[model samples]
Target: MAKQERAVRTRRLILEAAGAVFDEFGYESTTIAQILARAGVTKGALYFHFASKEELARGVLDQALTLEGILPQESRLQEWVDVGMVLAHRLPAEPLLSASVRLSADRKARDLFGTSWPAWIDFIAGQLAEAKAQGEVLPHVDPGATATLFVGAWTGVEILATAHDESGALEKRIALLYDTFLPGIAVPGALRNLDTSPDRGARVWKLHQAQHHARQEEAAAATA
Candidate 1:
């Protein structure tokens, strides 16, 4: 049991290290040697766990999805939105998720979707359907299409925000999107009393400012 646990831990380390390297250098440029060095594991051990680099890459992607909770299941639409927002905010702190997003943009990574994407989309669609049935969403809304659009919009915004390395801007964009988009689709009175509070927005802005300041301080310290 101890040996199995150790093996699992080692595999997780390799997956995380590989994901970071892949995020930093992309799939074509990343090498197994770099992953092994980062993980501090031997080639034999890596090979024992994964047959090839492709398999390892897939494992890295799978681990990322698991960590991010991207698979669709019994979660609600609001929960999905919240999870996506949290993931976006944490992307800067999570190299594995960043790498997963990068790989997801690749044509070859389509195969991974066979395992991850359907479950996630179906989950989102199910949530939307439930919302409609409960009269929380507008009766005319198409659940599947709305689910697809929501995922696309969120992913696009997240990618752009991450690319600019601007968490503050990202938060603002998301807030704007939620305020403008949700009301249009929500059932009458369902979200009428929603807080839509500026105070919340202000708090998010302040948090971003703090993060920005911390980054600058870290950079200065590195130079000092």
Candidate 2:
């Protein structure tokens, strides 16, 4: 049992290290040797767990999706919308998820659509269908189409934010996406007027500062 636990930990470490490397250098530029070195694991260890870089990439995706877990079984459309919003906001803050989004645009990754896109699309479609059935969306809204659009928009946003080194921009973008999409889907008379803007840039700035300070404090704590 202890050996199994250690093995699991080692696997997680490798995945996390690979995810960070992939995010920094991209899929094509990254090699298994770099991942192995970063994880402080032997090549043999890496090979034992994954047959190739492609398999490791799939493992990273699995870990990321596992982190998201199953969405709650909700009967309300509004509830599903809220859940989707949470997912959008959380993905940016997660390293493995961000890596997956980055890789989604790679030709090699797209070629592996048989392994990746279906599950992702189905997950989004399920959420959209739930929302539609709960009357959170317009009767005319196509759940599958909306789901595809949502995921596509998410991937695009992640790519743009990464290219600009604007991690803090994710929250505002998510809010904007929701604001833009919600009105069209909202049932008549079910929607209420509300201000969506909240000085997001300033809030993001403050949050970044807070994170920096927290990290500094943690470093100090570790050294002391």
Candidate 3:
């Protein structure tokens, strides 16, 4: 059990190191040597987990759909809003999510290793579809189409946000995204009820961390 836990930690270290390198330098420019140096792990250990740089890139891309910081909401559209806002809130600090964006836009690496954009789109589409079923969205709103465009807009907005300001501009941009888009899709009642506050992400993250820590403590107590 101890050995397995150690391996998990090592694998995580490698992924984080590789993500930071890839985020800073495009996939084509990154080298195994840099990741090794950053991770402080042996070549054998690195290879054991990720055989190649492409695999490491894939590992990072796979993290694009994490729901870690989102708490369930009464409104599905609100839940979807939380998804984007939470990501924006965490983007400045989370290399895995940011690195995935960097890699996905790199033509060479994108052709070599596919992205998780479709997965994110699908997830959002499902949320919108559920909201529509619950009468929260307009009858004319096409969930799948809106999801595709929404995700695309998010990508473009994030690129602009990072380029313009490093100081909390991301959340505002994300909030703006919903401010502009949600009105067309959501019903009047729902739109009025929805909270697209930029600070929504930070608030959700705090609650999520509190719940997560409580869960850990409960598990530890049970095991003890």
Candidate 2 worst ten-residue window by lDDT: 66-75
Model 1: per-residue Cα lDDT over 32-120, one tens digit each: 99989998999999888988778877886675553233333332445445545555555566677767776776565555443345555
lDDT of 1: 0.67
Root mean square deviation (Cα) for candidate 2: 7.5
Runs of candidate 1 with Cα error greater than 4 angstroms are 67-77, 111-115, 168-172, 193-224
Q: How would the candidate models be sorted by TM-score, starting from the highest?
A: 3, 2, 1
RMSD of each: 9.5, 7.5, 1.5
lDDT score at residue 21, model 2, on the 0-100 scale = 85
Please report the candidate that would top lDDT against the real structure. 3
Residue-level lDDT of model 3, residues 1-224, one tens digit each, is 69999999898889989989998888989999999999999999999999999899989888766878879889999999999999999988888888888888788878998877888899999999999999999999899999999999998899888888768899998999999998799989999988899899999999999999999999999999
The per-model lDDT (C-alpha) reads 0.67, 0.67, 0.90
**Residue 209 in model 2: lDDT:** 60
Clash count per candidate: 0, 0, 0
- Tell me the lDDT of model 3 at 118: 87
Candidate 2 global TM-score: 0.75
**Which parts of model 2 have CA positions greater than 4 angstroms off?**
67-75, 113-115, 193-224
lDDT (Cα, 0-100) at 75 in candidate 3: 97
TM-score of candidate 3 against the unseen true structure: 0.94
